[model samples]
Target: MAHKNQFQLLASRRFLPFFLTQFLGAFNDNVFKSALMVMIAFRLAADQANALNNLAAGLFILPFFLFSATAGQLADKYDKAFLIRRIKLAEIGISLVGVVALISGSNTLCLAVLFLLGVQSAFFGPIKYAILPQHLRKTELVGGNALVEMATFVAILGGTIVGTILSGASDSGGGSEWIGGLIIAIAIVGYLVCRVIPDAAPPVPDLKIDLNPVRQTAHVLREVAKTPAIFYAIVGISWFWLLGAAYLTQIPSFGKNVLGGDEPLVALLLCSFTIGVAIGSLLCERLSGGRIELGLVPLGAAGLTYGGIALSVIGGNLAPLEEVSLAAFWGSPGAQMFLFHLALIGVFGGLYIVPLYAMIQERTAKALRARVIAVTNIMNSLFMVVSAVLGIVFLSLLDFSIPQFFMVIALMNAAVAIFVFSKVPEFAMRLLVWLLSHTMYRVRHEGLEQIPAEGPAIIACNHVSYVDALLLAGAVRRPIRFIMYKPIYEIPVLHFIFRTGRAIPICSRQKDPEGYARAFEEIEQGLKDGDLLCIFPEGQLTKDGEMQPFKAGIEKILQKTPVPVIPMALRGLWGSFFSHKDGHAFTTWPKRFWSSVSVVAGKPLDADTAKSDHLHQVVLGLRGERL
Candidate 1:
């Protein structure tokens, strides 16, 4: 089937209602949680409020630990559309209970409602991630995720602000019955929207449902561990939540005790942070060219650490404002600096998360994608719980101020990022390419590790620009033999470059059957010589900047050579001066001396699994949707 357009995907009944359902669910959650927090800070006795607030936070997150395993199983076993509708209905019931608690003005009852909301969210977790691949195309995953994240966080900011305002209004009136009513109304809307979500059939429809959470959780863990990359991605995701939960839990306390800001100011701080996250999420689709680019993970982590340090320094410089204005909310010497740090945190937070999410979706088997997401949800919950406890320790035992706490967190983040990148050099390599492309033009790669970086290999890339082979040569440490078109090999000016590089040329079977036969023999000889041969499987440059189908010539070569095939993707070359775009080569140079380009290489695929169609898809995934 042809891929759906982005707008169509966005507007479709399949995605929109589920989007709203999740959005409203997130919003209602923050609304109640924030409202309760406001009550603890402003209305209850200091000791009593602290105890109640801490308990509420713990109870809410407790469900993730207890129910996430069950949730994953259910998501993998049931139709997600039906499951989501049920969960939304559950939310309505929970919100109604919240209404009764609010009317009674009982803090205990309100806290219970918070716990129940968390429970509902935990159940929705697996289905939330599991349903996407069923509805969207491979190319749309990153953009879709970005949109979802943007919506979720926007809901969070709005819910937080609305909840705080509503709680404050009720306190002034000596009651908060209206806050409960507002939550119930939102829950109703969430249910209605969920009913409209498109149906997603169960992946493992006949799979057994594990009623025992402990055994089930263990099983899920084992399942995930089967794929090391997926497991690490889960760890990466959980650590991010740990960092976020730690940072977010401290914001209100910091605003009030450290910055001496009021409730409204706290809302402002949250708004800025969420806005930064929203903007960053939107940018992910563009920056990654609508694919999961794990390289951004390190970049995001760097931002988080720096932003944390910046916040810490600004907190240390806390001073009273000389003047206050609407702009001063952000510019008020104390608050302005604080908001700046928060915004930076959010920006980097966006960069860090969007790609990890895309990676999880892309790498996992489609059948288990949602279950993996549920695993992530559980991990996030566990980390947040750990964070809350550590936070308390830092605040009480260590006598660390909020800013100092952030500084410590920032340092830890740097350490973790370095470790993860070291383990996954692909991220580090991409970072190198990203930096180099932004700095130099006409960059060329050669030697490619003297052709045998490890073993016999066949390197395949799309035919795009005149300099593609050069760029690949420059980036690879191995020496490689290029299989060029006959004409390009015979070109007067370029022939010497190819000859010096030891490139081989071949004509099509129709043009010269004997020549094609001889070229395959040469490739086989090169493989026997333990040399790496790079072939452009697309055979010719794309006239419209889209990948053409593989020419099947490589199939014959691979059939004969029997070497590992490593697919490479070259991006930002289509619009370059030497590209087939703009009617011809070297006709239109970029305005800048250094145009951004990327040469992404995937891990080697065994000759057994290196079918032409599979290789094509892998290349497309690597090139991303934009190419």
Candidate 2:
């Protein structure tokens, strides 16, 4: 059965076993790690406990740095389902060792177990993401990713709480044996759950394994550098992890120092952020209409910045109290606002990350997908470590207050977003298209599925307004290269989008013969490169709310590059502000706001029969008096 929403995947065998395995694994890891940290804190001296906690954290992250490259090779060389089962079995053995360590009170053994768990996680990391595309359809990618992200954060929150509670119970005269049993039970169950996962055959089964971590990691990084879009996506994902880690690490301190709240209040803060992320992650599928929407990335960035700035301002306004209770903290100035901003950051964070992950998985070559994921994991580890170091420098050495540090991080986020988006203008162009489609008009697409999913094709449409290209861009899933009149292509802000979208600008032969030739050269190159190209068959916008006669430019295009042509029409745009209805385009006030518009596409027509007149008739019939 087809799934309408991400949650429905939970009920299907194709996804359920894998989802449970991933969720259980993350849950078990955090449970053990949190329990270990809590146990050390309560049992050892304050200084000793602090040192061991830091050591434990370092141990967990070290495996990714050391073994990730090798692990990526293994994932690419073997069935992921088989690897996952083996990894889960190893987790059971590790948990058995952890049980003995916890009950025997051996700090060294506990740290060793932590390191082993990290190793297990490192090996599983690449397979976890790489397997999704093997199982899910292209349309389901975003939803699948959203569900996974939501589950992961939820697992973190749930596991942390459970571990903390179990550790506290032990401190209150409960025996350590209970914690041990629970850990062993979780590991065993995880193994059982993973056993049923469907086999994911390796993409590069014949590839030789590289045993050296340094050489393999360097090699992988070089491969990743070849695709700048995927590389920057990895950077963007890593930066997000850094940002998230910074906020999570500081929250407890923020609660106690800034708000003068207790452990309970700190937990509440954590809940706010985690729950918000869960909501936002789930919302991604809905917001993007189940597609990997790049537009949401910029929106998420904006929300994160706003949330951070608001938090800093609210935090600066608060007065620290002496041991404030949760109830009293709620009554204190800015408490509600503080929590809201934290949650907002998390919500936008979810919006920011899901699409990026889906994009990486979809765009990367299948043979190298796992290794690319491995590179991202390594970068994530490094960025998180850097975040910790920077935290120390800002809050300790630089003597910046918590609020000021927050402000600095927010500004850094802005700067980083600008750098990434500017480097890849597709993101910025998507943002503009998404905003225009969502705000200025309500666009309904018809027969869009007729557009080819891959390969080169031409789209000949009736151009009703200057914004028709933007609307079409948003409506179609694949990116399009527009062939537009030079004057319209050069509209200030719109020019940035068109140029970034690699649009071709042309003038009449009499006006500029050289420019006209260059435009056709670009068009031919674009088609040769397997790009989707769109042209306004009418040549220009209509002077009235009526169909304009199709021009010969499309015929010229087809003569040179005979791709299948899809006739399209835009309705309800003729009288809009961007159209020349009562006066020249954009010269008069808008006739309406959030007006209804429709983009109707027809089935592909053979290049030989798709003459200008025939295509114009088809588009007009499709439009069907809507204007």
Candidate 3:
């Protein structure tokens, strides 16, 4: 079957409502927060402005620390659609309170409303991620997440622009109250849209709600710890938020105080940053080939650090132009230069985050996914709080200007990224594989990460093409030991590559008992040394696309040295030049530059259930119904 296009997936009722709901929520968040910030900056007491603005920011983020644990538990325990609707209803109520505060003209009440909005977001956090896998197929996860991310950043830009414009206009005509009312009205519309979100069944219906924040938070942390990769991914995500929060909080002040820009200029700076993120998000689907490819995280982080430094350097170089014109202010040569740097930052940001989000969804178990996301939110909030405090300390004690501070942050981001990638060589190795596959062919992967990073992993895949091993090897980050037929393993030119890759030659027991014994012994030794050993249980390459009967060799190997057996299925390989399906194998390569293929890896099966028939069926399921 032909794969579904991005438009079709995006247009479905299942996805659109949730998309709109999330977009609206993000938009409203920025609108309200930006509007309030503007009010404090321009209208509030001048001497108290900084203190109050800082306090307001703190209040808004405090709810995440206090309520995210509860929110995560609730999302996992209840139907997501119902939970979302109720959250929307609460937004409507919060917006009403904003209206009342505006009419009453009380800054205190307005700040209180901001705090309430934060609480509302904390509740919505878990449902946002938990609902995704339910609505999207495994193939669509990357694209779906990209769209959601794109929409969110776009909404953030829109919100900042709207809030700035509305707040400025209100300042002139004493219509700030009316604008506040209008914001509330928009929020109510958002709630109504959320009501139309399709139902998603809860993952754990009988899951008890853990009301104790500390205990619940601990429980979620323990759950994440079960998967080492997932735990690290969470830490990476938290670090991103920390880096982002600090940079975002500094931008407005940077533009106004450092760059000598006005309110509109500050909005433009934010817009540039967010637009970069949106672009990055959209590019993820194409780059990852519709899978959660974590390799891009390093690439994205590199861009962020580079862009930040570029922006800072540009800021330091600011000078008076020939004419004091609006165009000069908006797009002077220097301003243009800065904007270019910001856009690069956005492009890279897109590369870094999209894959991480996809990995989190793909790796975690279904039941615990939402709660894990909730844990992420809590971490994000805590990081942001820390960032705010750090920003204040750095600025006050060291007297670092905004430009200098951003430079420091850029350097810090680079340092942290280096640390992460070094600790996880798998990321770097995957990046190498990703680069090779994209350069050579339009490769698609389903279960690439299923291959054990270390130790004995018996990869049972249906033999379809000569390139199957290459594709599998490229997808996996670890070195693999492929048990191959002796004839193919001795091919003059290909033999060198195979030998270097440490592939073992295997022969039928009746044909060569010594060769068979050697292959089995080699595999056992590999397991002892913690190496990934892959065997095609089908024994020979398929002449046609249909699967062949399982070879009992895999059963024998496991019987003697039992280890985790991972079942895999490779699709769209039969018709390629490497496959024997055509009159002459390797005669003609596929015409398309990026034709899609899928390699799915199912959950590891224990040795006891690793029977030949059961393993055969599992491989078929991973391949889906396509082949």
lDDT of each: 0.78, 0.89, 0.79
lDDT of 1 by residue, 207-264 (tens): 7877787787777679878755577778878888888888777887777666566767
* Top candidate, metric TM-score: 2
Model 2: ten consecutive residues of lowest lDDT: 171-180
Prediction 3 global C-alpha lDDT: 0.79
The best candidate in terms of lDDT = 2
Better of 1 and 2 by lDDT: 2
Pull out the clashing pairs in model 2: none
Compute each candidate's TM-score over C-alphas.
Answer: 0.74, 0.94, 0.78
TM-score of 3: 0.78
**Global fold similarity of model 2 (TM-score):** 0.94
Model 1 regions more than 4 Å off: 1-9, 40-43, 172-175, 321-337, 436-627
lDDT (C-alpha) at residue 45 in model 1? 84
| Candidate 3 residue spans exceeding 4 A from truth | 1-3, 320-326, 444-457, 460-556, 561-627
